[model samples]
Target chain A: MTDRPTIQRILTGISGFDDIAVGGLPASRSTLVSGTTGSGKTLFALEFLARGISGFDQPGVFITFDERPGDLRVNARSLGFDIARWEAEGRWMFVDASLEAGEQTPTVGTYDLGALTARIAHAVRQIGARRVSLDSLGSVFTRFADQDLVRRELYRLAGMLDSLEITSVITTERDADYNGVTRQGVEEFVFDNVVILRHVIRGERRHRTVEIVKFRGATHRTGEWLFTIDPEDGLVVIPVAFLAPRDRASSERVSTGNTELDAMVGGGVFRDAVVLLIGSHGGGKTLAALQFADAAYRAGERCLFHAFDETRGQLGRNAAGWGLDLDVMEASGLLRVAATYSEVASVEDHFLRIRRDIADFAPARLVIDGISALERRATPRTLLDFVIALGGVVREREITTLFTSAPTARGTSPIMEIAGITDVTLVLRHIEGPGTVRRAIAVMQTRGSAHDRAIREVAIDDTGMHVGDPYPGILRLLPDAPVPPSDREE
Target chain B: MEDQPPAALTPMATYAFRMYVAGRSRRSQAAEENLRALCDFYLPGCHEIEIVDATEQPALAEEERILATPIVIRKSPLPGYRVIGDLSDRSRAAFLLGLPDSGRPSPEGQRL
Candidate 1:
């Protein structure tokens, strides 16, 4: 048996792209990036060059066919890329192929793109560029009426780039989101690698995803992965499955803020555990979350508390009503409260914002008070993915996190789909007593440890939550459903 | 190569042409020949042609934003026109270049 030479790869420096690409794009080869209009194809192409220059110290050439170099410079500046500076430093070059206004070039007979190829080669040699990005081949197809000639010339151009040992990205446009690979059928065939960017409207919100169709003589993760275009950071592919597998389990316990509830959960939850608190409205779920945050603050650990259903003032007032001072904690620099309505942004945006907050604050403990409010804006599957992706983030850092959710009217919770991922599950329900209503709490499941199986009565007073003795003979704990009558009265 | 025209030809208005091509390839040579033939029969002794090899002077090609090879630019006159590819069809190329047909030879007698 003969051993084949392994193909070398060059890192694209795009966040999360390298992870999904396994290593990066196959080195010294051209990859075609195809997308529909408004699918961020230009942004992707620009970032590939920008990141190569900024992150890897590798010079690049950007051959623009759709947008002018000045427009691209201004557009790239929004993403914090100093393309003009890079150009001045001899690290970046632009081959302006975009048509000028009022410019007309009438074709008379046979012609080839030899001049363009010469100009690209000149720029590449001038800058000693290792990377090249040609934005939107669709413009070239539109400019040249002869498709066969354009395709043949582009294939030759790719070969020229290959001989120069330059890794290149050529972007093309797609007519539809899920149609064929590109507008011209020959584009994909001309390149060795193909990547598709999709911007689809799901549930009335725009969702962007990237899928690697093929990488010749190489391996990559298949299927569509979610990505977001940030105004400040450019393109960021969300690699949900790329999270490092965490096997570092902490046996150390941490309080859930209230000591009595801690005792019910067998000396508190694991230090790196992800605890989910499920309850109905006015069932003291937020109170438990607030207590969790307060405990982390008192323990001298920074905590990030995000509330989706309430404003900051509302949260402060609610905390004050429970005799907990949120302002003092905020001033102490150990607690940061971020409050926003769930409808303000899409679920993916929310995830990005929270991820940014975590990165900035480096909080040891994180709490999301009302995740169910986000459920209204996203589908059930998206909601579950959000939690899983969020879990991937916090678990990698071993940050103790808590999420509170309200059961749906259907009596099933979206978080139930991710039950195995959670280390601790806490359920709170409202009990209908004789002419009165009382609240009950239970330690449903504590992974790797034994916990109290009894259903106990829970009370929220000015001093906050207090866990009392077990409520008698309550077999069911469905929040919205009618609770069965207790067999034995307390 | 033609020398400077006489002072009387200046009254006819000089026609300046800049042709961009990729090196000394066959298509470029053909384009240069066809352009000289058209200029000789029409503006005869009054036109100036400059052939630029894009491979040797890429900066000039970049300035012109040239893509396809063997393109001719009518740089003189108030309105400039650009025609890409080898000028194989002289009549169509002349029409696109806005050349006056008053002094043109008959189609049957012309052999280009």
Candidate 2:
């Protein structure tokens, strides 16, 4: 049992998004996605369908309960998603029941959803679809008086979809404030996966985020991820960067080219443990992660690190000056560096892919350099589970986990739960001390063990992660939420 | 919070009237009686009357630019002609909106 740790495999066919989803959606079963109108549920489902056909070569169909086939096709076409064209090509089938589908037909009494459910099944089989979407089922309960009817139809509907071997997304209209509690209680339990799309109002601005609440057969990152739907680009996701897992840090404990850095991390980080290095932007989080990797490699230890917030090419090119030759390490299998953009993934995909890498090489040390990236793809809860599960692996297999967490400068600290639940929560803050301000490190909390709690100043020169007593002029790294671009709007 | 007077009246310009007052204040009752007599005397079938009280429709009062004990702003439906006072003189009220009053205000005024 002391053998190497293994990575889990899951694939979701969407591009850019899959990058944030980690590798991709896990293969097989169903995932529930609940959101309000215009929150991009159908778009997300369509993108999944498009990817299923184009990337995975799986024929899929989309059955709409709200919009008509003609309208759905036209809407999809405007976004370069020509559903009708795909239908003609035999890759997708678009089915819309305008009257029964849309709630436009108001009634004083209840309605029947059996015909609609049967129609969805028939549509799924008609096109030989391996993937399908209900588009919506909020109005499904409009007919059934007893809540059990809604539960039963959803269960049978999901069962039918599963029997067809379809990895599908069933979207429902959910409240803006998501509290992990589901309204369609039984339906959520029936599905193998649940993704909650939430529109959050931070300060005065509204942000759309997606979180995977439950993935029964697999481990998923459950965190709120900021997402956007561009007419031309579809759903674009950007994940906050934080400590990454799956990639191990070097235990060689190389000096932070800067001597002070060595003392800050206690003669460098220990081997095979989850070390969370946190700070604000430009607070040297990335540089610190790099310095440790460089130190270990120079010490003749194999280092495998994957940075999700950046690309492999960009990271290598940027840090070339520090005598950190990522290109060489990658070729030698001594350093496996990969940079992934969150817009390319949902957190579930991210966890799955990282799980994959962890399995493949079974590195003695794995570092998810910035965990914030996965937060964009998952709900906070799923992200927590993903991290807990990751910690379990790190402890059981003895793989050192070192990653960076960059905090925001706002009252709302969304990443707190994730940071709090981690094994080690360190803060690289810029604080004012002795009349001057500079970078500092505070050991917030490290469970199961005790370490330095007092904060001390840290500096970076030619090397990285230097520690010293308090400095007067430098600023303290205050926690804040990263603002989105749309926030600039008046 | 007092009621406003009947606004100016005109053939082209609307006999726009707003009954502004406090929560059934004394001034409000006086304004209401004055407006009825004034409207009954002249300028018929060419006015828009809106009854507003600060204790009730405060938003409307602000929008109509009412800010005194009893004020009325009768405006020309065509351009920028207005009057803010009691509509006791039929000719003066009509003249404020650049119109000559023919007779008493019409209960069924044509909507502009």
Candidate 3:
């Protein structure tokens, strides 16, 4: 490690991003930012320069080949960044080199960015800038038919900025392939770092994700990070630490609210353990989990309940039927309820919301009313990662949490496979008796302790939930109920 | 840098020229003189010339899309035209300036 050269970094000032980048961007080198149109590429580049001047006191220059400087100033102003003031203060410079549409100019045999180079050098010297950005040089590539010339000129420009010791960022358009990081493919070769931004529309929602494709000479987080562009905060890269394992383990056990259920799981779940309640609709999963949160709150411990499947008013009304006044609990500040429709936010954004609520409320116990709603919004693979990440974040704070999930339509409980990750996995399902159906609960696995293997009958009333003794007779149980007969074959 | 009002501002004869230069360099002086001589001969006293010294106003280069020094832009008369290098060559300058060669003959017209 001592032999490795020291890698100085420049802070991007984006919240949660520096933690993943380990300490902001690598210093004094070119970084290529590739994204599709309207993916907030220009806004990102401008924000970096703007924050560098305002937050880090690093003067900068912005050379745009796509937008006029005046228009850029107006746009920045609307975003609450006073770029015009920065220009007047000699801390920033905007160079516009955009050619209008249908405007043609004659080009000689071989030419370089001689004029652009002079303007940039002058701006740099004028402000003693430490950062520079070329909004887009994609149009410049069209001026030449030969790719080799474009490549050569790009290297020359890179060398010039290197000599000036300014950390430069060049934005470019992504190719149609979607797999390729940049349009020309030569930019990644020339720059020391490359970041790819993607805007994907999934189920009528737009999701923006960014991935660091290349960071030469250093290790970077390997996963694609979710990012959001707020008018005030610009680009915020979600930290990868959400997946990091935390050294938080406790042998202290807590109650499950239902006496019979607590007795089945040896006494209670261990602190910091994630309990997943797998069930289908009308299986009383949310009611059972809310009983735990209500019990924890009644015991004077703070609890946070995230309702993804139901609104606050609906959840409160449902809980009120069982004499659990969620509204009163929330008013007392002992129970904090966060509600949102799963479809309203991307999975990653929803994860951040949970993390934020956890940080702000500092709850000792938590419940995600319906985790399966998240699984429906994202791919199975992505949902698995999200579950693991959420578990990590919760366990790190030693928050005893319960997650409710419904098995798939095929009666397969996906969360059951990850039983080893959770401290307790209690599966709830319906069993068909002689001409009748009954709800049942089974404690699948309990880490660090023994649990009863017998499946017991469960019943929910207006008063509360009741769990009976284990059934001794032959059980005709299903992991989850089969689909309803609305379209069943005749 | 000089700005001259058009003699008539007509839809056709009222020409508009925007010249991008770099200070008092020989190239800049040559471009200015060549443009003046051509306008004096072709559409004599019927054109407008606006010289922008990029060395003083670097932003003007970007505003005008001036990629090279001693560049000229025929901004008016509907469609515009742009060209690099000092505007010294007669035929090339006329072609870039969109000045039809069927005008009144002059001393410089003989060379073209």
Candidate 4:
């Protein structure tokens, strides 16, 4: 390992902190932070160490003389750090030496900062820590009397961290006014970086401000950055450039398999687009997704189909019966069917199982039969998140995906509202007329393209789903006007 | 009491719940009624029964997690249990409840 700091990602697991630090603390070097009591000194250290464990997958050693690790763990949940659990996970090591209340005078190396540093080094070797911290170096100094010795120990410890090439954050309690002046102002000169966190009561509001005093490499805003400690999000560091959130998606669409569905769409669903086919029961919403998969398979594009509502064999047979050519397709390795249920398979586990398939099979088309299938165990929001994340995969690999949803009960608003994210929305309905039930198809809306708004009767026979005529459907309910059938000549 | 998380107190068994169904007029209403009937007649005691009249309390179904009338749910017995279907079918209500193998089977021999 080199003695110099590496150009590495800071890996602060704290959600907002990494972004605020513009991706994280400088690796392979120590940063000194000094603050008074209740000024959020310990919180910053805890956040750094805990986040290193969870986010960067780094092990951590916290050397302390102030309080028991138990107290720290309990206190940390409010800051979103389960210190004890991290210790249990073997990612955290606590070196503790507590003082009994009212203990008497001691000076000059009463606390072993050097021995604690060795233990921290040992834990780092054990857990392979890329980061470490010493809670309140001043605590050790509190009991020691030799100023020269303290200075030497402090210099040696910071140099050791630098030599080992490990990123470190060492906290020191300032004497109320020494936010700028360190103990001899010596620790500030020795450490590679110095960050000061202070509490400022401005006008009636108690505010927290963080300022990076010195970092060896790269520049940061000179003005103090404002922040808050929320119970859920932990330490939230406000980024200087956060007003413009990133727009992660480009306009796109995917295929629905059926030509009528395609005609309902402009040509095909946009690449990397998430399309939702929603319809009432027997309205062939699931069939519509299958129709898309079949067309993709026929066109030499492999498709991965996850049928949560039906069996894989049964789905294949059904498609074959409906003239979608499943047998030849599956034999040709153009189609993969996974008939899974959320009961036996958890939503996340199921996603994990198919994550490889999405990566390995790299299908030109992917169908989650109905995203609603996973929405049982997976909430609509989570399901939407998964779809959105998967959309990135589609964008990277240039693939299309189709999701089916049982229309939100007959009259309730659409349950599967994947519409907002789709390049196209196809609506299916079973319109009962002339003592006969007819499957109807309509292009409700297609973003960025002109689509047919006419409601047409849809059918699936020995051939496939056929869209022919506009019927007096949800789009047409006026009396004295007759709607045409799919097979009828107008 | 099986030594689980506090949140686990939220009902683990969403089955055997009740659905209040009165009648069906519109497609939404019919879907809700069909769902309720399917859940009730299929799941039986696994679900509790509560059929209210829309005519009596037309405003009852309004302003809920649901907007339409003829909605149904498993009474407030379990934590985090949901209210679903203004008027749905037996298949969905049955599947939602995770009814026993003895309960309604799909006409196509499909067990949801």
**Highest TM-score scorer:** 1
In terms of DockQ, the best-performing candidate is 1
Q: Against the true structure, what is each candidate's TM-score?
A: 0.87, 0.42, 0.72, 0.46
Indicate whether candidate 1 or candidate 3 has the larger DockQ. 1
Q: Candidate 1 on A366-474: residue-level lDDT in tens?
A: 9998888887787666676677778878877878899998885334545565454678999897888768899999887899899999999998899899999988874
Q: For each candidate, what is chain B's TM-score?
A: 0.83, 0.54, 0.77, 0.44
Name the best candidate (by lDDT). Answer: 1
Q: Assess each prediction's global lDDT (C-alpha) against the native.
A: 0.85, 0.59, 0.75, 0.61
- Candidate 2 per-residue lDDT over residues B1-112, each given as its tens digit: 1586545333444555655554565555555555555554554565666666554554454344332323444443444443333344434454444445433353455321
**Residue B60 error for model 3, in Å?**
7.2
**What lDDT score goes with residue A358 in model 4?**
82
> Model 3: which residue pairs collide?
none
lDDT of 4 at A277: 74
- Please give the RMSD of candidate 2 to the true structure: 21.1
DockQ of each: 0.76, 0.01, 0.22, 0.00
TM-score of 4: 0.46
lDDT (Cα, 0-100) at A442 in candidate 2:
72
User: Candidate 2 residues A247-334, lDDT tens each?
Assistant: 5443544344345544545554455456777777667677767766765566665566778777877677657755567777677766
Kindly provide the TM-score obtained by chain B of candidate 2 when compared with the true chain B: 0.54
What's the TM for model 3?
A: 0.72
